[model samples]
Target: MNELAFTSWTESTWVGFDTETTGVNPNEDLLVTASLVLLAEGVKGDLSQVETANWLADPGVEIPEVAAQVHGISTEQARAEGRPLGEVCGEVAERIVDLWRSGAILVGFNLAYDIRILEHSLEVCGLTSLEERAGGYGPMVDPLVWDRKLEPYRRGRRNLETLCGVYEVSLDDRFHQADVDALATLGVLAAMVALYPSVRTLGREELTDYTAAAHQAWAEQFNRYLASQGRDANVEEYWP
Candidate 1:
C-alpha cells in the first residue's frame, strides 16, 4: 500500500541557531559570535547534531563590558579574531536563507531576539531582510515559548539553564557559548515533544501560529502587570 506515515517532530531536521551579541537590545546590538547546528535524525531515533558553521564579527564598535561579562568575549578578542562586519553578516544571512530554502525549522531559546537581531544585521549590511529572503519568519520552533505553554504555573526566571533542569536534561557545557547553547536548545526541544507527544502532531505552520498566539496572550498579561506597578513594557507579542 502506498502510504503517508506520520512522523513525530523529532523526525524532521532542524537548524539550531544562537548568537552571543554585544547587547540585549537587538536594534543596537552587534553580533559577537554565532553558531548554527544542523540536527539530523539518527536511525535509532536519536539526534546527530553537527556544527555547520560559526562566526565572529568585527562589530566596528566596542562590545560593552556588561555584555562581555555575559558572553565572555572581550572587545579586544573580537577585534583580533572577528571578520569584517559586512562579510560576516552576509555569510550568516546566506546560511539562514539556505536553511529556510531547505525547509528546516529554526530552533532556539528566546528566538525572537535572535531573529530580530539577525534581520537587523542583514539590513544594516544592505542585504535582504528576513522578510524579503524567506517571505517571513516562519517554521521556527522556540522551546522557551513551548515550556511556558506546557508548564504555565511553574515560575521564577525560566532561562535556558532553568528550562534544561525542568526537562531533566543536563547542560554540561559552559553556558552563554553560542554553539553549546544552540545544541542544548535542540535537546530541550526534543525533550519537550517527547514529554508532550501531542504537540509533536502539529505541523510546522500550526506550531508557529500556536506559539504566536501564546506569546500574544503572555505579552498582554505581562503588560498589564507592568501597568499595575506603574511601569511600561512592550515586549513583542510574537516570535520567529
Candidate 2:
C-alpha cells in the first residue's frame, strides 16, 4: 500500500491532556478533575514532563463511589481543597486553547471524550469554543486510537493500566489520577511510534487526519473481532 506524506507534525509540541470527571455524560456530569503536561519539556529519553498542575473542582455535586473509585477524589476532600468548579475548569480550558493557538498539538488517550468535556466546560464558562478559537484544530497524536490502528492483532486490555504494562510505562503512583493518566497516555503514544516505524512517515497534520480515520477503521475492525469471538457484535458506536 502507498504511504501518505505526513511530516510537518513531527516537530510540533505535544500537550498531554486528561480528566477524571463526576461522570461520563458531558451535559449532566461535571469535570471534577483535570491535568495537562507539556511533552516538549519532558524528561530525558521519555515524553513525561514536569507536573504543571493537578486541578480538582468541587463539581457542585457529590462524587459517587463509582467515580471516586476511578479517580480517588472524594467529596469531602473536594469540599476541603478543590477550587470552585468553574474556576478550575476555566483555567484549564484557557491553557488548552492557548496551547492550540500557539501551535502545540494536544495529545490524549481518548482525546474526544476529554476534549468534548473541556469544550462543554468552556461553553458553560462563557469562553470561546476551543474548536473555533483554534480554527478546527485537533491533536498531533491520540494514543488509544493510534494503538488500535497500528497493532490490530495485539491482545489484552488496551486501557491505560494494561498499556502501562505492555509499553513499560511507569505507573509508580496509583493509577487513574489525571496527571498519571496523561503521562501514561504519552508513554503509550511513544511506544506505538517505536513499535511501528511507518507511523513516522506522516507529518503533524497528516498524522492527525490519519489517526482520526484509523481510529474509526479500528472500531470497524473490532466489530469484526466481536463477530469472530461469537459475541453480540451489534453495537454502533465506532469511534467517530
In order of appearance, the predictions have TM-scores of: 0.90, 0.82
Q: Which candidate wins on lDDT?
A: 1
Q: Which regions of candidate 2 are displaced past 4 Å?
A: 1-8, 41-51, 124-127, 223-240
The C-alpha RMSD of each candidate to the native structure, in angstroms, is 3.4, 4.3
Q: In each prediction, how many residue pairs overlap at the backbone (N, C-alpha, C within less than 3 A)?
A: 0, 5
lDDT of each residue in 45-131, candidate 1, tens digit only? 344536568999988789999999998989999999999877887787778878867777788899888887887777777788876
70-188: candidate 2 lDDT, tens digit per residue: 88889999889998877887788778878877777777887878877777776776777767776776555778878777667897888878877887877555677888788777776
Locate the minimum summed-lDDT window of 10 residues in model 1: 1-10
Q: Evaluate all candidate structures by whole-model CA lDDT and list the values in order.
A: 0.78, 0.72
Query: How close to the true structure is residue 45 of candidate 1, measured as C-alpha lDDT?
Result: 30
Error of 1 at 202 (Å): 0.6
Residue 57 CA error for candidate 1 (Å)? 0.6
Compute the lDDT of residue 42 as modeled in candidate 1. 13
